[model samples]
Target: MKQVLTIAGSDSGGGAGIQADIKTFQELDVFGTSVITAVTAQNTRGVIDVAPVPIENIEKQLQAVGDDFDIAAVKTGMLFDAVTIRTVADSIKHYNWQRLVVDPVMIAKGGASLLKEEAKDSLIKHLLPLATLVTPNIPEAEALSGIQIYNEQTRRMAAEQILKSGAQGVLIKGGHGADPDFTEDFYLDQHGGSLVLRSSRIQTKHTHGTGCTFSAALAAEFAKGKSIEEAFLTAKQFIQSAIEHSLNIGAGHGPTNHSAYRHYAQKEMIRYVH
Candidate 1:
């Protein structure tokens, strides 16, 4: 079986971060491994507290995973500060690992800051260059590119600037946009080609871990030997189904159902055959 690694924080709620990543990996039929950089005391409602792991321990975990598993792809979720970002970059370089997916998780669903303001520069400088694909939401894209994303023109401009940061590609997620009907995610490939993935908006509040799950599914598909475009499409479909069949476990924002994608695909196949 193929293996993938998630270097991110642990979400105690099992709705986002490492928990969501692992769940998505499992549902996608990949061996899931992780290096927890921090632990959040959070649930559906909000993040009560966060404790960042020590740099030394984080390095040790990465080295351990590298030594044991042949990680086919890797994804990052929340590196709390600049030091952790630098350490993670150095570790990835040392491991000589490619197929890196960087999910620039800056804020939580409850408006809590996951990435420190000071560490944004470190992420762009130390990590973006190493990323095979950097997945950023609108606000994140705006912050990374130092521009406002209002429409297609500005969104494309932000994507271009982010690619100039040395990332091979960028996916600007349109979840935060003002689209009333469809959520459009824009993808800019390394060769300057672009693809737009559109899915009808699901009116629900159970989108706590959408970003983490999308990047995780993307990495899992890559580990399974799918092409970048193929993996991106599968990831989009996965997230869409997961959102449409969201779970209702928490009082606040719940999590998307990771297993819903496989079921949805099976049903679609059956419908197609009939």
Candidate 2:
């Protein structure tokens, strides 16, 4: 089986962060490993408090993972501070891990800051250059690229700027935009090739872990030897199914059902194979 790593925060909520990533990896049939950067006192409601793991321990976790497993791909989410970001970058370089997916997780659905303000520059400087693909939402893209993404032209501009920052590719998620009909995610690869994936918007409050799930699904697909475009489409479909079958549990933004895609895929296969 393929192995994948998630270097991210631990969401006590089990709705996002490492919890969500692991669930995603497991459902996608990849061996999942994790290195917790921060522990957030959170639930479906909001992030109450965050305690960042020490840099030394963070390095040790990376060392342990790199020493044993052959990680096929890795995704990063919620690196709390500049120190954490730098440490993760150094560890990735040390391992020489190339299939890196950088999910620039900035804010939670409840409006809590996951990435520190001071850490943004460090992420851009240290991590972005090493990323195989950087997945940023509209706000994150605006912050990283200094381009306000009001429409397609500006989204393209923001993605181009992020690509120039050193990542081989940029996927700007358009979920936060004012578009009421479709949730369109824009993609731009290193060679300037672009693709836009459009999906019908699911109106619901349970869109909490959608980003994490999407990136994790993409990593899982990549580990299974899918092309970037193929992985992108698979991940897009996964998120759509997950959202459609969202778990209506928590008070605030709940979680997307990770197993929803598994069931959907099985049904799809059965229908086609029959």
Candidate 3:
């Protein structure tokens, strides 16, 4: 099995962060390894507190993983501060890990700031350039690109601005969009290739780990040597299935079913335009 690594925070609820990444990797038949950058006291309701892992310990964990595993791909999420972002970026450079999926996790579902307000610049400067693909939701894309996305034209402009920041590709997720019936994600690469992926929105409050899960699945697919377009399509299908069969275990927003893709693979569908 191919090995992939997730450098992210630990979610006490087991819905997002490292837990979701590992679960997604397992469902995709890849070996999952992790380096926890922060630990959050969170549950379905909201995040209570977050403690970032010390910089030294974070570096040590990365070293341990890099030394031991022949990791095929990597994904990063919920890096709380500038120091953690720089540390992760340096480690990725040292290990020469090329296939990197950056899930720019800025906020929790309940409006808690996961990434620091001051860390945004560091992420743009130190990390974005190294990313093979950067996945950001509508808000995050606005923050990164400094462009307000109000329509399809502005969305493409924002993506182009992000690509200028050095990421090879960007996927502006549409889950946070105003469209009530359908969600559309826009993908743009450095080579001028673009794809618009659309799927029927599943009405549910249980989408806690959707970003983490989708990016993790993308990394797993890349680890297995799939093309960028192929990986995005598969990851889209995976998240749709997970959300369609979401688990309603919590009182607040619950989590998407991590294992649902395998069971519903034949039933889920996503439409894309190249």
Model 3 CA deviation exceeding 4 Å by range: 267-270
Q: Judge candidate 1 at residue 274 and give its lDDT.
A: 5
Model 1: per-residue Cα lDDT over 1-274, one tens digit each:
9999999999999989999999999999999999999999999999999999999999899999999999999999999999999999998999988899999999999999999999999999999999999999999999999999999999999999999989999999989999888788888876788888777888999999999999999999988889877888889888989988877879999988988987876212111100
Residue 152 of candidate 1: its Cα lDDT? 91
Q: What is model 1's C-alpha RMSD?
A: 3.6
- Per-model TM-score, in order, reads 0.96, 0.95, 0.98
Q: Which has the greatest TM-score?
A: 3
Residue lDDT tens for model 3, 1-274: 9999999999999999999999999999999999999999999998999999999999999999999999999999999999999999999999999799999999999999999899999999999999999999999999999999989999999999999989999999999999999899899999889998888988999999899999999999999999988898899999999889978879988988999988875444465566
Q: Give the range of the ten consecutive residues with the poorest summed lDDT in model 3.
A: 265-274
Question: Local error of candidate 1 at 181, Å?
Answer: 0.4
Per-residue alpha-carbon lDDT of candidate 2 for residues 1-274, written as tens digits (9 for 90 to 100): 9999999999888988999899999988999999999999988888899999988999999999999999999999989899989999999998988689999999988888888899999999999999989999899999999988898899999999999879999999878989898778888988888888777788999988888989988888888888888888888888889888878988988988989987875212111100
TM-score of 3: 0.98
TM-score ranking from best candidate downward? 3, 1, 2
